[model samples]
Target chain A: MIHQTSLMAIAIFLFFASTVIGISFYLGRKAKSASGYFAAGGGIHWAVNGVAFAGDYLSAASFLGICGMIAFFGYDGFLYSIGYLAGWIVALFIIAEPLKRMGRFTFADALDSKFNSRGIKLAAAISTLVVSCFYLIPQMVGAGALVQPLLGFPHYVGVIIVGLIVTLIVTTAGMVSTTWVQFIKGGLLVILCTIITIMLLVRGISTAPTDANGKASYIAKRGVTTVELQSMGTVVEPDGAWIGKKDPVTGDMKPAPYVRIKNAAGVVSVWRKDVVKFKDGNPDVTTFSETQATYTVNGKKNVNGLPRGKGEGEADLKPVGYLSKLPNGEKETGSQTPWGFLSTMQKSEAILWANEKIKDAAGVETTVYYQKPTLGSDFMTPGSSPTFKKVREEKFFGKLDFLSLMLALFCGTASLPHILIRYYTVKDQASARKSTVVGIGVIGLFYVLTLFLGLGAMTSGALDVSDSNMSAPLLARSMSEFLFAVISAVAFTTVLGTVSGLIMAASGAVAHDLASNVFKFKLDDFQKVKVAKMAAVCVGILAIGLGILFSKMNVNFLVGWAFNIAASANLPALVMLLFWKRTTKQGITAAITVGMISSLAWILLSAQAYKDVYGWDPATAIVPFSQPAIVTIPLGFLVLVLVSLFTPKPKDLAAVEKAS
Target chain B: MAGLDFKGSGEREKEDAGVVAHNTKLGVWLFLVYVLVYGGFIALAAFRPDVMKQPLILGINVAVVYGFTLIVSALAIALVYMKTCRK
Candidate 1:
């Protein structure tokens, strides 16, 4: 797809970036001490910290990935919404208040509060770094995805820009500026999405969506075309129409949905074939269809015969995602209530895009994107996408994968280091609980609006079939260029807010837990803050590299893996430390070590990593299932229990009993 | 300057151990209730997806209705916990 560099988008993006950096500089004066830098001096208001929670929590995965998933797969995307919100219950009810009472700088502080063991510190700190890096991948990938269309830059360049800016933000002021940045962007993301959803409802669903230029954004046609069979193992059609091929083995005629054609200019292209039946009995007529694009990859570069940008002869990708048939054969629904919107979509038929890679006998590869007309019932169901389609399969392991993912998402939110540290930004346990309640309300509202945003994009006629992560921003562009610019800028800030928070968490772990506590460093608070700043820069660079490396995977799916690791590694140790009386430092350390390694090893050996990351056959993966939380979480709990039972009681148990 | 003041009024009222215990008890109960509801949603989606496809209320299918309910219920449960738990 050809993307034009928009002056408006670039201008708004600069404005947002400058304002964030300006806030960092302004707040930098107060964050000189370690407390100020790491925990915002525990001074952030409950409400502001609450919105920052939304900002920190709603990374690129929630906005871009979930919206893109819904646009592509329908109701399956909403599953992430539900699972994410559900995880907050664990935060509010179980982790928030107790965690606030225990932790000072990082998740390690809370875990080591009881035993004060260096072993627990080392285990928790490593887990924090591992989970933060895991979470950072999706945010960075999202940063790259936004840059492609918004700034008209390459994916790696976008990742680098965000990496540098976020590193600056973290190095300058730490959590104080990070909190405010998150607060502002969090508010903007929710408000802007609400506005888009309102416009979507006002505009309503249409069978034929039009671009801002009033051109029909989707292509759907049927007409008979002549085809001439060639003798030299090739098929020819005068108008580049799709033609059937004779099977080499059976010598029988077979319909080919996509046929390779060499045009009069000798440029090879692929055309789609559609067999249409009319009421007048048109003798099984065939018509030619326009394919989305014929993508060619030579080494690392993608070259399309079509134009790249908006030059004089440049052409953009055809806007897709239109309803093939509206309810009751109406061309459009003028306006809709929220429920009316769902009910209307229930009875409609949508034209969803699916792709297939074809290699001709000459070994020339072409990717053909075709439209499938799906019933609204099936569209709104859970199994529309390949990721979640396993839920509908008969195999138990298929369903187990879906169950494990939901479990991970539910448990992972409370265990994330970045989120856990936010509790310290507030003053006391009460503020922690209150801020979490506020976060739940704000985040829940945003997730609800995602359904509309995703469904709106699904029929917006502005989707790039090749990139699903651009769905929301592209949906905004379909409405107006100005909204698109604002949304894209806000989306960039969303990444900025989340990445800075993750960096803060990682740096805190490095300087405080590893350097100060475990290694018994004699550094003062000032020196510790300096070390943390240095650590922030290093982690930021690492995140940028991983972001570029894992560019092809969907952002939300990567987040799911992060959640699995966080839940497996951290949740067991943290929960047992709080609730169980027999929990020893040895047990906590063992649980953290075992959980982290088991989940990491499981993911590396899983089919998903083999196929997407390693480019190896998925069947060669040793793990029976992709998600590890279902097995690994239980393993963590059991390991903690057995280890604690065998280890001696804490040496401080008597002093603690006397004090109580 | 006000935002920089690390020690705020929120620190003045620390809950006693009794209050903390009571809140923990209340929170655990609420957490269990949400777990059951969330587990049911996951089970249906994974095992009984046919049930999820069937419409339960207002012409919307069970999957969407249940999914929306989970989100709204989380907010509702949080609000209840905030009101009832002694913080």
Candidate 2:
């Protein structure tokens, strides 16, 4: 109800983001030399780089997406934390030293090491731009989301302001400012999150969470229409006519009852009462009366638009726990352990809190059923990642979807060009390795704390179910206004850290690789740096626009697309070039191109895309409904194998330069 | 100059050397490689949990199995690389 915290949070976050921008501008003059700008003269300590790794790695997806997931779904959200931290191993053991031992500024530099093909430079640069831009979208959107509750600013304003600020951070100092900003953000983010988690443990779980209205707000989704009560609950109709239920035997009009909230004691009750729906233009100002009775679930029935054809193992989407169960007769654990009461359904299956009146096939008024997530398995269940929707309504399939998402997250990390570039910022392979270890510790700690933060939010009564993104900040709001302001501000910077790093990588690719080598521009080192700054501005704008466009998509899900693209396009070519000597420029080129294109096409044509982006019927999407990794990663390897065999090996680097 | 031979070929070397004053770019690429591999493992932790889950230490999922294995293995790789690449 208050936009009070928003101003303070915005002011504080702006102060932080802008100060970094000023520092970058001051330090960035030195970065005008290609070596300095690209790698910070390769003198950064592994410790600093290590924390910077956390800054770059902990994107909007990690903060908002993971917190939102944990808040809404129990234990399932922590799975993301574990998955994200695991990807560092691939970078540490498999790719680290050899990659350092290989090439220069871009992933293309390492990739084009042997062949010196312009094709390699061109392709890798393009892939870097695409993946970096994709990743930037979520960061920008996350910035906007945090700003809304924190600063009370409009969504696009948050997006635009963050974009401009990041552009300033990048164009001024390039990697120098980018690194320090991330360094500060990374350190602050983890420490603050750790504090929040501790507070959550101390607070424990509260059975009675007071609302602003001082009355329990009962909400029900009736078909397409939603009825929410300020005090109890309100019901409205589609054609503007309120619907009332008739007594089955008495043939008399009876009002639907909301939960007979008994809050005199500290714990609340979930008893049902009846009231007739009466309308006078504004249906909200109406009265309710008790039903003077209680009803049990005679038989369970499916209520959604589900056409009941599948069996239990096939489609038994059951609820997890009762919102209100009676004492003695009802099995009660701690009122807040979401998983313990998950298996049993409550005695009262349906609580008819409110309904919406809609036109039926005959064009007459009809009422659609309104119910909560059932107690058995349906409540606290995972929803589809756009028809990547596995059997989440069931147990095993839900776990598998969780598995699939984590799989992408882990593999996606090492493959990212921006993160890979950080390895080069530190001196020597040893620093690279040690820096990573520190990064793991920092990132791992933050992830573990996310579980507490999420669970805290889930039980925090402050959650707005309509927007899962609000889980963390809203949870903070329940604790204290000041904590909410700080956490919300930190979350906005979290977007700032990742997006700036991503833009830096994309800019370098365009200026350093695409313009200089591929197009053969004979520019001075200073000119190269100038081009990079311009590229940062361009990439920053694109990121902001896409962030606003995809404002509504879940931050976590949007990141999955970035991961899928990075793993497909970048990893295959990189792995082959390092391990297999037979790899020609043709093969590596084909693999990278194929991996990037195929994965992008699959995700774009994906059923999830059909549902989310194109608004098509999900069932119409024909791919085997799976992560493209199992197919695309290997395809990249295979294309490299086949193309390398078929095409003539390009001239060796020594001979080519001699010829030139 | 003696150890790196700044201008000399290794046991086998390519002749296209544009030797700058420092080894800045090579270091950056190596860092990039580390970042990618690190990212890959993070993805694995997310995607494949059991592989990373070592015994819980003080109720904390330290990712000990993954963490220890990574440190040890990275050390081993660095050792082998230094040994083989010595001039």
Candidate 3:
């Protein structure tokens, strides 16, 4: 896909990125001390911190991935929004005030607050690094993904660019700049998305060019028509369609088109295949391509990539929202109320796009999109995704997978190193609680807007079926180029805000939690800040490297794994320390170590990993399901409890005593 | 402990401690409610997707209504937590 660089998008993205860097340098003076660098001098207003919390929490996964999921899959995508927002309740009610009161810089501070144990510090610092790195991969991946469209840069170049920019932001002012950056980005995201949702509502549902009886109308052709051509091997028909090349071995004409394909290893190959019909009786058609012969004006084809309406593409993608029937038996319900829109859509026809990998006559594999007209209610229901289908089947492992993922999402927010650190940004426990409430409100509202943004994009005819992450941005572009530029720029900032926070957490874990506290490095405040800056640079480079490596995975799916790890590693100890009087430092250490290792191993060995990362049969995986939180979270709590019961009591018991 | 009392007022410490205890009890109770509601919703989604697809008052299904309700309830509970716990 050769992306055309839009000057408007470049200008807007540059403006936002530069403004963020300027703010960082301006705030650099305040970050001279370790305390200031790690915790923003603990003086931010609760309200601003609250919005910043939203900003930090709403990463590329939330904005790009979830919207893309909803655009492609329907209600399944919005499930992520609900699960994410619900996590804030844990942050607010369980962790917020306690974390604010106990911790100074990192999540380790809270655990080690009672005993000041080096073992506890070491375990927690490792856990923090693991979780932060896991989370960082998706953010960096999203950054790379954004650059392809916004800057017309290659994926690795985008990763490097984001890494450099984020490192600059973090090394300059640390939390002060990070917090302010999040605040602005969060506010803009929610406001702009809300405006987009309103625009979608006003535009409402209309007849697509395909739906209307026009030159490009496919309304008459419902199911795919099977066409067989004469066995013309290696022949280009007068109609411009390529035919199968002759097999060298058999000297027989085979109906397979030969095309060159580049694999992940960057090796180009011409793969060979012969057509074979499946038992289902469907023809083994490699791909479907209908040339826009009628789209020519004055012997010139229409401008490529100028959207469906004006381009050589099949139909004009108009505002398509509400339909009257399940599939095209139409009484058109035009514009509707928010409630009306959803209700009408439930009974309407939704033209969803699906893709399948096809091997041409040459073994070269490519994905092609085909329209699948489905009932709106069916599209809006669960089980549309292959991941969630087992739940609907009432399968035990499938249900467990669903439950574990949800549990991780519900528990992960409070445990995330970056989010826990935000509690320290506010002045006091009261401010922490207040900010949490505000964060929940802001984040919740934005999640609601995602439902509209996604569904609007679904029928907006602007979907790039090949890359689901670009759904929301393409939806914006369909409206106007200017809006698309602004949306893309803000989405890029979304990546920057999140990656910066993760780097900050990783750096704090290394320098403050590990070096100064755990290893007893006798570093002064200035030296600590210096060490942290160096750590940030290392972590930033590592994130960029991993981002490029995991370029194929969806950001939302990657975030789910991050949540599972965070919940498994951190939640049990934090909850136990605060609520249970008997929680020992040894227990916290053991729990963190065991929980982190177990969850990480479980994910690496899970079925999804076997299929996606390792390219093996999922059935051969050791774990029954992919998500690890259901098993690991309980294991964490059990380890903490049993260890505490067996271990000697802490000499100080300050945390328990204070609670009593 | 000494560093914790930043304001250096004994009365303030006592009041702060009292607030913490009060907030803890309320927070725990509220969290239980949230878990029950949210957990129940997830259970329904997993076991009975068909039930979730059933239309509620509007043509809107049970899933959308419940999801929106959860969002609204989170905001409402947050406000309630702040209101009752505030000094």
Candidate 4:
């Protein structure tokens, strides 16, 4: 969708962006050493690192993706927020301090710390790179999605721009710059979203057609019947109705099968539907009016200022998400409390728009948005989207898939390479625990706020039917254009913050875990930093390409798959190494390798992959369901136990035990 | 033996091992609590979705309330762990 650029939006976006880049430059000098490059020299304040955790964890998936999901699918979207935040329990209580005590830089550092095995280093490093790559996709895709609206550029251009910017941020200063960027981004996102949500509550809900001249209000008044119509003869208005057909000269019915009228204003109205004959029909009934024209400027198609997404030329796409009917037959609900807003929305009627894809005579596919009147109560229930419908219906596959996805999310948080690395940035084990607590507090608050932000967007009267990713930014647009711009820029930064962290993890896997340990490169500190920087650039490019390819996917959904992979591959190895004395290096290597490969293969062969990636029938998929974690995670633990039982104990485990 | 055993080395090694054991025991206990609450919600969502849809208070349903409870409980558990570890 091509959006008209607002000067205010541009200025605010530039200001926030430049300040981030400026911080990276200032911190660049501190990141010259290997430890500083990868883990911020383990000197960052616990409080600062804590907020940075929130910043790193939130990502584009939490901000843009969750808000967009809730805006479109109601309460189903908030489930992701809940699952994500709950995952932190595993992080805080189980992983944080132990991880800090074990690792020097990367996640592999901790895993290999117990036995100092090359096989463990190789497998953990590969898992880290793969998981980071998977996580980076959604963040990059989110960056691409924001560009079309924020800068009036193509999606690919946006992806490339973000890739370059994030590469600079990562290569220049590594973890130090990444941490501070996340800190600022996390704080700003939470504060601004809160302010905008308050504005939504203050403005409250009102009936559409409140102002005739406003396009948003006009679309809201008409609902979804906004098609253009033309008459054979002169059309006359009877009883003040919007649609009319009468001959002005003879006062007789001049019905025609089809007619096109070209007005002097260069607007052509085509009434293509059959005209209905009146048989005691209400004259006050109105059909939506449409003005169609192929806009051109300077002999080229000018998509700028034109409505983007579905129903652009034919219909005036309005801000949707209003109560078509309220409880007690009230037309509108005034200002509502945070709790009240949710309660009222649950009981009222919202006009949620759903899109249908139709092919024209010329075989050009276009999406048409239809108004769906959903009860507030039904909207809050699960199983609205295909993702959760089976679970909501309590079917066997649905239940299993739901359980599997939840299990992955619960374990994935502590196991994620980027998140685990954050533990190393703090000073000590105590600091790690304190920082995790702070992170949990900040992230928990922001997630609660997303519920309102999403519901606000749902009824903001400004929804783009075809795109779920744009819901939050468009909701901001409805409040004020300038606010939309600021939020969009912040949302873009959300992507950058996450991608930079993911890239840092991947680069560390390459330089420290893979090259230095696995391949026995034995580089000095300066050389290690150089290799990491080069690795950062390569990973950044790979993220950009994947981001553009997966542009249409809902970011939160992609993050779910990534979570499953991470949980399956990394968690068992990390957990057993800490708790189980019999866990051998060979067992750890086997667990990571089998867990990673099996989950990846399962996902690639899953029904969702069959439909989305291969464009094949979902029924042809080999896997029973899309989420692989329910099977793979337990498989990881089992593999580790069995293998460890058979293998000889490592001499290093005893040595480390005595040294510690 | 290099004189490096958590059980045999010295008082400090014994203390460190005790701390590790304590941490592991506490971690498992908290994890079970997490499984009951978080896992319970997922089970309820799959098997008894209608129960989740039932109204709880002020027009909010059981699911929304439970979801918020999970978030709040996570924070509580974290604080509890932090305090216990310090002790």
Q: Per-prediction TM-score, chain A only? A: 0.92, 0.77, 0.85, 0.86
Q: Is the docking of candidate 1 incorrect, acceptable, medium or high quality?
A: medium
DockQ of each: 0.62, 0.07, 0.36, 0.29
What DockQ would candidate 2 receive versus the native complex?
A: 0.07
Off by over 4 Å in 4: A209-216, A219-316, A360-362, A552-554, A658-660, B1-15
Number of the top-ranking candidate, with TM-score as the measure: 1
lDDT of each: 0.86, 0.64, 0.79, 0.78
User: What are the per-residue Cα lDDT tens digits for candidate 2 across A407-464?
Assistant: 5766778889899888767666656667877787777777766766775675555665
State which candidate, 1 or 3, has the greater TM-score. Answer: 1
lDDT of 3 by residue, B1-73 (tens): 1221111111112246677899999999999999999998898989889899999967899989999999989
Model 1 misplaced stretches (Cα beyond 4 Å): A222-256, A262-269, A272-289, A297-316, A651-654, A657-660, B1-13
Better by lDDT, candidate 4 or 1: 1
Give per-residue CA lDDT, model 1, range B44-83, as digits (tens): 8888888988877878999899999999899898889889
Query: What's the TM for chain B in candidate 2?
Result: 0.41
- Tens-digit per-residue lDDT, A306-385, candidate 1: 54445654445566888888878899899889999998888888888888765555555556777777898997988889
Worst 10 residues of 3 chain A by lDDT: A230-239
lDDT of 3 by residue, A439-518 (tens): 99999999999888998787665666557788888778767778888998899889988888999999999999889998
Residue B8 lDDT in candidate 1: 37
True contacts kept of 3: 0.52
Query: Residue-wise lDDT of candidate 2 within B4-40, one digit each (tens)?
Result: 1011111212222333212334434444555565556
